[model samples]
Target: MERFSNITEALMNEAKIEIESFDIKDGEKIIAYFSEIPSISGFPYKIILVENSDGIVYARFRQWDTEYDFTRWDNGVYNLDRLRIITDEKILSQTESALLKEYLSQLEKIHLPENINKENVIILDSSLWKFGFILKNKNIDYTWKAATEDINVFVPLINLMREKYLDRI
Candidate 1:
C-alpha cells in the first residue's frame, strides 16, 4: 500500500481491502459520509450502500438529516425499479451481476482527478467531519475517517459511487 501522504491512494487501498472482504453477504453494508463545501444549513450529505446475498444491492441518497431522493434512469433489463420506488430491498438478476462486477472493478482503477492538487491543506476548524467509510457485517465493523478542508481525492470517488448507485455507471 502507498503511504498516507497521498490521501486518495490510501483511501483506494483501504476501499479495495474492504471490497475484497465484502463477499456480498446478506446484510453487509458500506456507508460513507462526505462533507462537500458545507450546505447553507451546514450539514453534509450521506450515502448508504447495502449489499445482500446473491449480489443484491440497494443504495439510498439523502441530504443531511432529510428525506431520501433518487434520480430517474431509463428502465433497463434486470430492473431495480421496486427498490428505486420503495427505497428498500430488491435483487438484481443474474444478468445484471456482470454489470455490477464491472462497476466493482472500476473501484480498483480509481485515481485522483488530474485537476486536484496533491498538496495537503489543514483545516483550523475542529468541528468539520472528514470524509469516511464504514464497513459492517453480522460479526464486526470497521471504519476509516479523515477530516480535511481540501478535496484532494474524495470528490471523484464520491461522484463515481453516486453515479454507480444511481444506475448511471
Candidate 2:
C-alpha cells in the first residue's frame, strides 16, 4: 500500500476524483452543488455545498442553527431554489412539520440569487425531518457527518478534487 501522508492524499489516491467542466464568463462563478442529505437508515441528514472560489476551495455547508440566517456564498453564486422549504414530502405529524420548518429556516440563511434555476437545485433529504453530513473545524466546514469523519472521508475527497482540478500533485 502506498501510505499517504495525510487524509487529503488518501482520498485523492483512492477515489481518483474528477471535476466536470463548465463555462464561466470571465468573472462569473459556478455554484458547485448543494445537497440536503439524510442518512441511509434515515435518522439524520444535512445541507452541504462543494465550493471553489476561483482557485480556493471551501465548503459552505453546515448544520443548521437557530442563530444562522441563511446568507453566505462568499465568492460564488448560489441556487436560489434551495432557500425555500421543500414541501414535496408529506409530514407525518406536527412535530415533523416543525422540524421541516427548522430545516427550511436554515436553508434560508444561505443567500441565493433571484434567477437561479430549479433544475440546478439538488436537495436529497430522505425523511425530510433530519440532516447530517457536515463537519466543522474552527471556521471551516467540511461536507461530512460526525460518523463519516470518524472514518476519515472528508480530506480524501478534498485531496481527490485538488488532484483532479487543481493538479496539486
Candidate 3:
C-alpha cells in the first residue's frame, strides 16, 4: 500500500465533482472516503464515495467515451477527437449508509503496511484503489496498485457501492 496526498483532490477534479456541492451538515465530519481509478482499458471513468459522520454517504460515478483517430495505427499514433462524459450521484439509503459505517469500522482495525513494493511483479492495466479515513487524532490515506491483500479487506464495501451505483453506469 502507498499513500498520496492529492489522490482524492485529483480524482474529484477529473470527475468534475465539487466537494462543496454536497449537503454535508456543518458539524458533520467526513468519516471515510474511497476512490477507484481504472486503467486505459476503462479510461475516462472514476468512482468516488464519501461517508459523513451523520451516516450519510455520497457517491459520484463518472464514465466517458472518446473518439480516437487511429490513422497512424502502425506507427503507434492515436489522436483524440471527441469525448463525452456522463456523471451520476446518489445519496445512499439509511441501511446502506449504516453498513458502510460498519465496514469502515472493520477496515480501521485491519493491519496494513505503509508501503509495499513488488519489484518482481509487473502489473499492467490494473485499477488503483484509494481509501481515506479520519481516525482518532489523525487522517490516514491508503493507495494500492490493483488488488492487494492489504486492500482486499474492504472489498465488500467497494462491491456494495459498485453494485448500487456503478452498475448503472
Using lDDT, give the best candidate's number: 3
lDDT of 2 by residue, 110-160 (tens): 542322223444556332221222222112222422222232323333332
Candidate 1 per-residue C-alpha lDDT over 31-137 given as tens digits, one digit per residue, 9 for 90 to 100 = 44333223222323334455554345554443322112112212221212122122222343454445545544553455423233223555443223234443222
Write one digit per residue (lDDT tens) for candidate 3, span 8-124.
Answer: 334334333322233445655655555555554353454556655655677766554322312223353332222245567778788787787788677678765565333356787
Scored by CA lDDT, what does every candidate get?
A: 0.36, 0.28, 0.55
**Candidate number that wins on lDDT, 1 or 3:** 3
Cα-based TM-score, every candidate = 0.34, 0.19, 0.59
TM for candidate 2 is: 0.19
Q: Candidate 2: lDDT of 18?
A: 14
Against the true structure, candidate 3 reaches a TM-score of 0.59
Query: Which 10 consecutive positions of candidate 3 have the poorest summed lDDT?
Result: 65-74
Which residue pairs in candidate 1 have backbone atoms (N, alpha carbon, C) closer than 3 angstroms, thus clashing?
A: 130-147
Candidate 1: worst-modelled 10 consecutive residues by lDDT: 77-86
Which is better, 2 or 3, measured by lDDT? 3
Alpha-carbon runs more than 4 Å astray in model 2: 1-28, 37-54, 66-125, 128-169
Show model 3 residue runs off by greater than 4 Å: 1-31, 51-55, 67-83, 116-119
